[model samples]
Target: MANRCLICDKKKQVGVSSRHHRGVAGKQWMKRAQKTKRTFSPNLQWATVDGIRIRVCAKCLKLIKKEQPKGNLPEIASK
Candidate 1:
């Protein structure tokens, strides 16, 4: 399965990772910490909406749950 949110099309994003304690205590290091390439993946999970399974991100899942009680899931899930 593709690692993407079906609702909003959220996917992994390219970013940089670095050590947080490199310049702590006002001590300047001779060489700065190198940044490494990384990917920030969205929080995705499988969900069943209107009898169909789909992958959705955490934020969209929250919205779906919120609207479920109002019987408006089909409208949002279809998007």
Candidate 2:
């Protein structure tokens, strides 16, 4: 499977770790995403099985919502 999402081409994303401090100095590794995960990707990649062109972020699969409805119309127009 492709690491990047078919929509937005957000790349080079860094994951941060969150930990609670117990007065003493402490650090925790929050399993940051691999560098390879944040790589090159197409800006407008089409969706699978539906062909919905979208802009998404890799690994996160984020989509840019478009408030417009555009698609093919039926041969027979409904009244």
Candidate 3:
């Protein structure tokens, strides 16, 4: 399956991870701070919509569950 949400089209996002350390003198260690590239992937899961199984993000799944009335599933429009 694709790493994308069928409902909202949420996908992987690029970001940065920063690590900072303090010096022995209790001062800011600028050289010791490092930044690394990272990726933020969506929390995708399998869900059945209209009898079709597809992957959706957690956020969209929450909305879908919230909009559902009792045991009846609502029609979710895909993007």
- Say which candidate scores most in lDDT: 1
Stretches > 4 Å off in candidate 2:
24-69, 72-79
TM agreement with the true structure for every prediction: 0.78, 0.29, 0.74
lDDT of 1 by residue, 1-79 (tens): 7788888889999999987655656566755687899999999988888878888999989998899889886354345
Point out the worst 10-residue segment of candidate 3 by lDDT.
70-79
Q: Tens digits of per-residue lDDT for model 3 on 1-79?
A: 6799877778999999997666656555645778899999999988866678878899888877776656555455554
Candidate that would win on TM-score: 1
How high is the CA lDDT of each candidate model? 0.82, 0.36, 0.77
Query: Where does candidate 1 clash, by residue pair?
Result: none
Candidate 2 lands at a TM-score of: 0.29
RMSD of each predicted structure: 3.3, 11.4, 3.0
Query: Which 10-residue span in candidate 2 carries the lowest summed lDDT?
Result: 70-79
Q: Give the TM-score of candidate 1.
A: 0.78
Report, for all candidates in order, the number of backbone clashes: 0, 5, 0
lDDT agreement of model 2 with the native: 0.36
> What is residue 42's positional error in candidate 2, in angstroms?
15
Worst 10 residues of 1 by lDDT: 70-79
Local distance difference test, candidate 1: 0.82
Model 2 Cα lDDT, one tens digit per residue, 4-54? 543333344455445453343343344433333233334434433245443
Question: What is the clash tally of candidate 1?
Answer: 0
